[model samples]
Target: MNSVTKARYDGLADWYDDRFVTGAEPHQPGLLELLGEGSGPCLDIGCGTGRNFETIRASGREVVGLDYSSDQLRLARTRTDGPLMVGDAAALPFPDESFDTVMVMWVSTDVDDFGAVVREAARVLRPGGVFVEYGVHPCFNGPHVVYNEDGGRTAHPTYRQSGWHEPAPWWGEDGIRRQIGMSHVPLADYLNAFLTAGLTVQRFIEPEGPPVPHSLAVRATKPA
Candidate 1:
């Protein structure tokens, strides 16, 4: 992400905790189940309001929430007693193999360098440690589609296009674009990033079930 994007998040930081996050995220059930118990520290990458911290902690692990926005970190501090750090996900400020579990939730859509973030996750995770990803379903959730009046999505030609997207006719006021530009990564790229980083997939979960699942949660582990 660029300085512009960071500025946008900082601008929304004050209201962010309330405006966007109402409660525990939708993918929590699948995410927690896949991540399983952790005896050591679990890094929460792009951990906006630290909503996932409680769940990670519940699984017998120390939680560390990391985000690039300082304002987000300030809000997160109130939610999580765990250490909150202002850091970039692309170039995480930690040594290699520093965590027992590296968990990312609701992040890839906002950041431009998705691959770098995945690589960083793999780098920090110890061998046999899990990398759990919980976020928008890449296949169906992209800049190319919008939820229709019938509760289904209407596909836009721009679906295959990947990169930063400004809020437009397809996604205006009520969407994330109203806050900051979003990055649309294809499904292949999403999985390939983990594979290239030397992590092997253990489980792939879709929280929304069938007929257009809005979210996905995946668990992969670094080879021991």
Candidate 2:
């Protein structure tokens, strides 16, 4: 995990889910279904506000939500009675092969060295376990792209990582302004991270939603 990312998320922790997780967010249900209501521990990396913890518990599995933000974890503590730790994604505090499944949702694109975090995910999952994630689509989000005429539009090259990152501003109806900050990792860079972590790519999908065309979703596995 990048130190900068940790700082930003920590600042946004308390209100993170409120701003992002709504009924219509893409990939939440799809990722949950892939987990299959299993009977094992689930590790949610970057578990902002513990939004997924309830769903994980409803499936009869123990849940551990880890994030680097005290503010966010404070809110998460209120949502579910589970272990919430402040930890780095690149160097998780847990041992290898500890979880049956690991979830990295919307956090991959926010790291500096994504491969480090992916490697950590692989190290902590049991054999045959699944690692699933959803992140910004690198295709539309690539660098070298320029926002044309504003209002959620941009142009970019066909490559990833090298693409520019231009996040939109946040101004709530309460007349307060929230700053826009972001981190970028191209699509290919993300896929390679999983491979380097000794995980096998099972599936990748571009989830459909509004405000944008697609969000990338992936399911990978560690061989038993």
Candidate 3:
């Protein structure tokens, strides 16, 4: 993750879910349903607040949640008493092929080298295991978007510029996303990360929206 993003999440970990994403898991249900019936361990990357624990647990796998933010894990423990690790997403502290599944939730926008994280995720999952990602639509949301104007509008900006974007008055909303900062990854660059990691993407979809997609879910599998 980016240094600025790491600090931002570290600071907002405590009340992040409550303030911004108060409802159930913000992403589509298909993400969890894709977790499969694997009896082996499953790893959840950037598992902020552990909100997805219930869905992962119901899949009947030994679930572990990993996050870079101590503040987030502190709050996560209250929600699910599961094994949680405090570490970077780019370089996960786990053995190669240690988990049967790896899932990253809404963390792609924050990581500096998302491809590194994807490779790490593929490294940890056993061959033939699955890796799931539930995130806001990369092409539609984040820095290039102006939510206050026209009830959420997208502006003209080069999509390939992926990195930390500071808050500006024109962006709208003094929300924590601005405080914590964001990294905008274009749609193609986002998919390329998975391909470079040797994870074959099987399913990808974005929920309905006019100007842009609100969120997206992707399912990939490590080669057997």
Candidate 4:
């Protein structure tokens, strides 16, 4: 993880917790659906403020939450007694095949190398283990897209652009993107990261919401 990214999240930890404390985040239902009834030990990468701790634990899976920001993990303590650590998603401090399930939620845009993070997630996952990725839909969301007043989105020709982008004027003044900007990963690059990590894609979903789908979820597994 980038130090700047860590600092950004650290500063926003409190605001972020308060903003989503209601647990009504739109992408959550689909995230849980793709997560399925968890099994064995699970790793919740980028588990900001432990938002998904209850859902993951509800399935009887023991979860270890990890994030790049210590401040984020500090707040996560209040949500769950589960083990929380300050760590990089791209270089997980764990042994090979250490987890039966690995899930990363809303972290792609924050990481410097999304592919490297996926590779690390795959490395820690045991054979036949499941890997879940749920986050903003790359094709329809990101700096390349402009949201209009009528609930319509105009995707600019910059869909192929990948990397950190300046905050767009359309972004909410109080939004996370406006605060720290965003990194854009084109649709193909986003999906290719899993394939390159030797994960077999099982399911891909564009969850229902808004005039255009804002989020996506993917379920994959390491070959047994």
Best-performing candidate as measured by TM-score: 4
Query: Once model 1 is optimally superposed onto the true structure by TM-score, how far is the C-alpha of residue 27 displaced, in angstroms?
Result: 7.1
lDDT for each of the candidates? 0.80, 0.70, 0.78, 0.86
* lDDT tens digits, residue span 27-114, model 2: 3646666566677788999787777776677666787998877777888888777788988888899988899889886675566677
The C-alpha TM-scores of every prediction are 0.93, 0.81, 0.90, 0.95
lDDT of 3 by residue, 135-165 (tens): 8687677776666546666554745677767
Give stretches of model 4 more than 4 Å off: 23-27
* Tens digits of lDDT, candidate 4, 87-171: 9999999999999999988888898899999999999999999899988899888878887889889898777879888777777
TM-score of 1: 0.93
Which consecutive 10 residues in model 3 have the weakest lDDT in total?
Answer: 20-29
Instruction: Pick out the ten consecutive residues of candidate 1 with the lowest summed lDDT.
Output: 20-29
TM-score of 4: 0.95
How many residue pairs clash per model? 0, 6, 0, 0
Show the colliding residue pairs in model 2: 1-90, 142-163, 143-163, 143-164, 145-155, 161-186
The residue ranges of model 1 lying beyond 4 angstroms of the native Cα positions read 24-27, 209-211
Screening candidate 3 with a backbone cut-off below 3 angstroms (N, C-alpha, C), the clashing residue pairs are: none
Distance from true location, Cα of 191 in model 2, Å? 1.5
